[model samples]
Target chain A: MEANIAVSSEKKPTWGGGGVRPFGASYGKMMMWFFIVSDALTFSGFLAAYGLTRFKFIDSWPIADEVFTHIPFIHGEFPMYYVAFMTFILIFSSVTMVLAVDAGHKMNKKKVTWYLFATIIGGLIFVGSQAWEWKTFIKGSYGAVKTTDGKILQFVNESGKQIALSDFVVGDRGDDKVTQTRKNGLWFESGESVGQYSVAQVISSYNANPSIQIRSEKIDLDTKQKIILSREKGAAELAKAKLVVEGANLEVNEYGNTIFADFFFFITGFHGFHVFSGIVINIIIFFNVILGTYERRGHYEMVEKVGLYWHFVDLVWVFVFTFFYLV
Target chain B: MAHAHDNSNVKRIWMVFGLLSVVTIVEVALGIVKPDFLHLNGIGTSWLNWIFIILTLVKAYYITWTFMHMEGEKTWFRRAVVWTAVFLIIYLVTLLLIEGGYLFETLAPLVRW
Candidate 1:
């Protein structure tokens, strides 16, 4: 009885210090899994919020195809192409990462180093592509006029092809309104950078160009296209214009709904940030392999742990691709 | 120590890669084409959207199972991670969607342009 009590006392009060890796897993690996579970919930929160807003604006949601139609130097419209390329890049990087982990298990340091290098390169390319996509989204192709009720009004040619602001608005600032700047004692510093032309210019150009028609944000479910106003209704709707919105910002977006842009920026930006951090962590582990740290320690479990994180990132992208781009 | 699992997992990794790549290509094609029948035929949700969701789940399954080596983990640990996340996500999404549909049904009419 005395001997039993001595052993029990030595191991008493081991309440919480994280050696409790359930299922005989290492402490580091189990903790990584915990962090991943929590982070997954965080992303789910954002995606569910997006679903809420989408449902609220179901009738007038912007079509993903119409909004994200741009690739560098290519002229014509090819929607979802660039986003699909990005998805492939991330997936390929994930493959390389898994290979690294597999190599690590066999204690093949050279293969692990090379595969980790490829994964890092893939991550950098994905991040760069996202930056490009954001640029294209913020600088919209076809400018739209905002109604007093804060809805977008786009211009379509007679044949139903969308046209840009510079296409028909050829005159120099037709409106006599002075440009607002700090030097001129204008107190409107709270606004985004001043647009090139005034609302009057867009209005006058739209009025003079009889070949153009107004496309409202509302959709016709049967045809799944934006409802275009007739010639007479077009003129009347143009009169309701309050401002000329060229590109996307918090205040306005040329796309059908401003909330679409907001969600796009937030969700994609957060995912990209995660990818960026994963790249950094992989680089740290890669150096450790070259320095023979894992060799001395007798295992390459660090690579395996980091691989879990990399695959988690790719898993998140799969959902993002489905919801954001595909559906 | 001779590891219990084979070190020749390179083949399995490539097979998973091929599967993921093929699935992604199919998804991108469907998105671009958006066939009329699939786009229109559903009780409340479109058939095309359902297909996309199902395919995405399949891809997610493989990624989690093979790439992350979840299949090699203990059964209890795997269930602990997957089940908790799935249940919570579904619960939250269902409630939020209900509230959103209510707003659209009741409040959208009141806010006139």
Candidate 2:
């Protein structure tokens, strides 16, 4: 019976090896599906690890809504709406990608080109939007004061609005004065990278004015966070300060927390990397399509394969949207 | 050169896409508003979380079955792929929770510090 089955399979034209030929799909397409599944699993593992860490630090975890509130070309804080637009872009890209595949099936070159171009533009816009998001994240909003005990105490106005250190950091320093290097004071400087301005500088500048009082990194350094005093006293005490806002656990971030920043960089960076690769692949395929390579061959299976990949990107974004934005 | 999709099927695909987008908007609204009843603060084990998970699963199901055309495949083939993912996800989540709970308890002191 096994020999009979083997003989029967041998009668069919197997494009590639493996007796596990899927119905109505070439070996490449089958492999692509398998590859997509494995990739999906890998992404799931990373996201699950993210979930685990977030759950562990549930109380201290940064608020997603607050952090990702900014919109492109808009000044005010609008939570989730911008990301919603990004989601629409990706979903629309997926639609265009599928439409291209559909056009490919009918062998309509013009329609395929139009749809593919739309998809590519959509992807580019998404990448650009992501870059803007990263810029906003890196710049940070408000700074906090880190205490000797490694605790962070943030400053807020009477209305509980986060006051950016820059709001009070008044100085006329050159670009060289404000840089993010590895070391300015530490001689060891093995990394030998540029360093960001010391938090001390921000505090000193803030203390320069009389209206603002020195708030210790420790909320209970003396008694309350609000210190009442004149300019001379605030500046005098701020000069002797040893600690500053290295990082914090509030909505108003300073260079953001390393973990949050790292995750943001890593996850979005990885996704962006995928988009880059997809664009390269798309470009190659675009050239091929223009050359009428598949058209001459009388099959647009290549287009279909790439469409599957493009849609996979879209599908991943849907989940990323949920996990990173909504959740 | 092949004409696999008829005009009727094309229209159907667009209809499905519209439906999917509508469902997504609904999910987003639910997520954004985070209704009082859906608020998991005092609830047991977070019904909102469960709702979100279920909705996510539904979306995944639609995407896979309809968009990916997995529903058109052979019964055993579909089962093999879907069931493998389902079983593995279940196993992974279980192991993760168990190990995570253990680690959380063990590292509680260090964490507090």
Candidate 3:
């Protein structure tokens, strides 16, 4: 064994010995890999918690299709269409990133610059799309009533198509309840923005509209749809209304379980923050490339390192797209 | 850094992009249609879910191997990075999912269906 070790040592110096590259990978790249692995575990933890909560509340969980059914520019229900477009944009940006790295390897400055430009544009569009999605989610399409027991009751027609609050609700809210902002109220205290409608108005409106039926948050396993109540049952359920919920927030969600919206915001917000920072880093690296920093160094290893990070962001989005939208 | 002449593999890069795009299209199509046969039956999840998970893995493999240039990486580097993640993520998912199932069973009676 000592003879063999001596022979191996005489042959050539191995990596991780006196500033040698380990695993044929540079120090920067290996550190980046370590970051990616730890980040992956963090994401996995979040997803696993989501899975556990979803399973625990399987019966009352919101259906993905029903909640995410909005498309920009168009008004009708187009579930997952915009989300798919966002996914394509992100993936396409990743392609451009790899292309940029390839150009870097070839020392083709012009191609690298242009590809990097394309990638930055793609990232901008994706971040914008995510913002728009968040806006749409916050401004819910079909408003619902929150009962005293913390249950959600949405309205639907006989055909089971969800009807917006504007479709049937008709009455003026007599109570003068304005939004309590920090500036308007005590400087040290504030409250959530007031909803568009009030519980009293909604209750009166529901009492007037006999055609509108109530749909509870609970899903019928056999039908794979939320349980819609009869007209009499609808009125009885509406009588328990404690507040009017127009959109989503940290506390209340018109879609279904409040925890769903909580996780949605936390996970996607964290991911979005990553994408945003990735763009900033890319821009810096893009400028460095334009200034011939890597070219002067006679290697584009910096570009390759950043490419790994960019691709990792894209990779995380793939799983996010599946879990949040597709599933 | 040495293989400057062979650095630009434009054709292979585009081919990988095409493959990823096609796979994404297939995933979206399947998700939208949600064929009844695939959605209704499975061991734990539906066959559709299994298909999605499998296709996602395929996409992940291609991205890591081709775009990330893991294909050209040394064997130990590849194993150190990929194998560690694969094993840990699977283990985490399995334990979490099993615990979640147990929670569901325990709380099934309390929650109104």
**Candidate 1 global CA lDDT score:** 0.87
In model 2 chain A, the worst 10-residue window by lDDT is A216-225
User: lDDT-based ranking, best first?
Assistant: 1, 3, 2
lDDT tens per residue, model 1, A147-168 = 8887888999989988888887
Looking at model 1, what is the TM-score of chain A? 0.90
State the lDDT of candidate 3 residue by residue for A107-200, as single tens digits. 8899999999999999999999999999999988898999987889999987889998989888677688767666665664455666678889
Model 2 stretches with alpha carbons more than 4 Å out: A1-20, A148-152, A168-257, B1-5, B40-45, B106-113
DockQ each: 0.72, 0.25, 0.59
DockQ: the better of candidates 1 and 3: 1
Q: Rate the local accuracy (lDDT) of all candidates.
A: 0.87, 0.65, 0.85
Instruction: Tell me the tens digit of each residue's lDDT in model 3 across B1-113.
Output: 42544645777788888888898888888888888778777777778888888888888888888778888788999898889998999999888888888887898788542
Model 1: what is its DockQ? 0.72
Candidate 1, clashing residue pairs?
none
Across A1-327, the per-residue lDDT of candidate 2 in tens digits comes to: 456454455555544644455675667777777777777777777677676665554444555665677887778777777787887787777777777877888888888888888888888999999888887776655665544434344444444455666666665432454434545564453453333445556565665554555433221212212333345554554455444443322332343233665666777777887787787788788888888998998977788888778777777777777777666
